[model samples]
Target: MREVFQQELREVQDRLVEIAELVAISIDKATRAFNESDVSLAEEVIAEDPRIDQATVALDELAITILARQQPVARDLRIVVSALRISASLERMGDLSTHISQLARYRFPDKVVPKSLRSTFAEMGALDVEIANKLTSLLRSEDVQLAEEIRNEDDKVDALHLSVFDKVLGEKWKGEAVDTVDATLASRYHERFADHAVAIAKMVQYLATGDWDQSAA
Candidate 1:
């Protein structure tokens, strides 16, 4: 029974990692759509949400199966529970990425968008990709220290957001104020993207130590 339970745990975890990887790709594709001014890619990210949703459901089923069949006890119970919570967080991250894609479709077609801000948006997108990739690594390693590193790394995205805001939301924008809306939404997307990354890290930490901290990082 012990060995069987352990095998189930490994299978669930591996599937969790796979789910994380696909969501990361969704984020990257959505960001790329923004940078490249490609509406098709943006639509692709939005369409991918069903996959994330399906994965979340599948994970829940796996956890329930373990709970019913093997009767997980103590630590095993906690890990299985954490797996459900982590999958939900991962699904939210996927939704946030889709939000970015939707914004790109809203703004880019009219050519009112400034050419100068492209690099800043690209930087934001790149940071989001990094966050997603790091979370994927954390999915496998589940190391507390590495999770801290990802939490700390969020500052970069925040700084990039500030820089974009200072430049675009100004008198020097010279009545080109519609861009403000674009910048504001972009800032929010990146900020929330980093927040979800940190959330995943926290979930991993909980799985490892059986100690979950809401205030973590």
Candidate 2:
């Protein structure tokens, strides 16, 4: 029975990694769609979000089953609890990516980001992808170092988000209301996606160290 329970734990970890990979792909494609105004790619990202949602739901059910059947204690309990939290975070991250793609689709042939902020959006997208890829690695390896690196990448995303606001509000800003709204919304989605990644990484770090620091960097 103990061995079987251990196997279940491993399975949960594997599922989390799978979700991470899918989210990475979603963000990558969504970013491209936003940058290039590729409605097809945007639609693809939107359509695939249901898969990520299903995976999270399934993983949560499995974790609850283990908790009821095995009544995991100590580190085992921590693992199950953390799995639930991380799964939730990953699901939100997927939704954020979908939101970004939706913005692209809304604007259609015209780019969501204006020419003035194209470079900033591009950098944000690239960093979002980088942080997502790091999350996959962190899930697979459970390396605390990788978790910290993910947080650092998130900081960069946050900085870029602030920059977007600065440009939009600057006196030199000449974008239409719709353009400003789209830029604000899209930048927020990207920033939130990175924030979710950081949240997941912190949970992983907690699982490894057994040190639950709510103030984790």
* Number of the predicted model whose lDDT against the real structure is largest: 2
List residue ranges in candidate 1 displaced over 4 A: 110-113, 175-177
**Model 2 C-alpha lDDT per residue in residues 1-217, reported as the tens digit of each score:** 8999999999999999999999999999999999999999999999999999999999999999999999989999989988998889889999999999999999997888789999999999999999999999999999999998988888999999999999999998999999899999999999999988988888899988877879633
Candidate number achieving the greatest TM-score relative to the actual structure: 2
Pairs that collide in candidate 2 are none
**Model 2: CA > 4 A from native:** none
- Which digits, one per residue and each the tens of the lDDT, describe model 1 over residues 6-92? 999999999889998998899899888877778888899999899999999999999999999998878788788878878888888
Reference-based lDDT, residue 42, model 2: 96
